[model samples]
Target: MRIYVNEIKITDDSIKCYTEESTEGLQEAGQMLVDSDNYSFAYILDNGQSYSYLIFVQETWSMLHENKGKKIIINDNLELEQFESEFNYILDNIQGNLNYGKEFVSVVEDTFELE
Candidate 1:
């Protein structure tokens, strides 16, 4: 959904960044995006710093799917009430969607941080 780069908010739809060395060494990884349209809607990353891919998707799902079940550093300060409301909204709205996986709705709180 949202990634903080040096504490700057970066959403999934943001533009991509890359380093010079990656141009050749990561040719296959580069091709991974160029060759597939489905994945084009997203970016694949291996957890490096600075230069990385910018997945093309909505903020929340991208973050949820990308970092599923993984421990990530989130904002140290956040609003608990607002977070719970948003999480509940997502769960209630998308809960019955089998394509998105019914499990996803229940998993909202697991993917976010609320101080």
Candidate 2:
């Protein structure tokens, strides 16, 4: 799966994002990557400006599991040809939050535990 950050194209090599098929058949949200990895998700959000995320959680309540390779989510749902337009207006709004963000870092340091 491919996620676009502005003109920068981020592929599956760095991080993997995906959804799990829930028992109820609804797609549950989750991501899979190294526990110590730092991931940056640009929140202006597009199916363009959006920051697609990945995490490996031990808890099933969150619906994220790390398992066999191809089955794991690299990118899903966000890459629709129909939604493939540039996120022009959304990108404009990002400057406001990042400027005043005392807590929010551009590249976020998110560490997960095995539990």
Candidate 3:
């Protein structure tokens, strides 16, 4: 599966994920990823101003996973078409609920300087 972070796309190569059949299973998978130190996960979040591309790498997953439903703001945007394509791809490939409301891919928002 793929995820859009602003204009950038991230795929499975850079991340390790688990697809579960139920929300409970999904939560368990997320918890497993969070407890481990060798995996990372990505999510897309919007906080009014822009969408945030957040990633949890190595040991960082635990902290983020603790506040599961909270919104953390990061500056980013994504193309609707690309996001949809990736979303569909995940549904097609994974045999589960797969609708955790987060993208399977991850990207960092670009920083710009005003002239």
Candidate 4:
């Protein structure tokens, strides 16, 4: 599967993320909203399942401090363990931004296949 980050909207109160996936075909995958200062991230999956969580960043206070928080959106219809595993895999493999103090945010186009 190929994941494409389509757009990112940054605002004072929240950060809204939009993404597309090219697997069987190109399709909108999901959206994520990170509310400012609260660290609460809400995800609306492609299949319409929703989840929210509080993310704690150990570093990059300068980068994320003003945006409130950030969230990543992936494909839908995954079990919690599957989702967590895939998420960890992405984090482990992706390169970090040197200028942002390890807090990397970008439009990603990468292959990620799940068993």
lDDT of 3: 0.28
Q: Candidate 4, after superposition: displacement of residue 88 in Å?
A: 12
Winning model by lDDT:
4
Pairs that collide, model 1: 1-59, 1-63
User: In model 4, where do residues sit more than 4 Å from their true spots?
Assistant: 22-115
State the lDDT of candidate 2 residue by residue for 1-112, as single tens digits: 3232221123443223444421122232322222212222222222333334322232321221122111222344342221112212222333334552423222221111
Give residue 27's lDDT in candidate 3 (0 to 100): 14
The residue-level lDDT of candidate 2 at 54 comes to 28
Which model, 1 or 2, shows the larger TM-score? 1
Candidate 4 backbone collisions, by pair: 36-68, 37-68
Candidates' C-alpha lDDT: 0.32, 0.26, 0.28, 0.33
Better of 2 and 4 by lDDT: 4
lDDT winner between candidates 1 and 2: 1
Candidate 1, residues 1-115: lDDT per residue as tens digits? 2222222233443312322222222111221121122322223333343334433333344444454333222232221123223333544444444455434433433433311
Q: Worst ten-residue run, lDDT, model 1?
A: 26-35
What lDDT is obtained when candidate 1 is compared to the true structure? 0.32
Output candidate 3 Cα RMSD.
Answer: 17.8
Per-residue lDDT of candidate 4, residues 1-115 (tens digit): 2233345455554444344542222223334433334322323334335233323232322233345334322232222223333344443444343332222322111212112
lDDT rank order: 4, 1, 3, 2
Q: Candidate 3, residues 6-34: lDDT per residue as tens digits?
A: 22222322222222211121111111111
Residue-pair clashes per prediction, in order, are 2, 5, 2, 2
Question: Among all windows of ten consecutive residues in candidate 3, which has the lowest summed lDDT?
Answer: 106-115
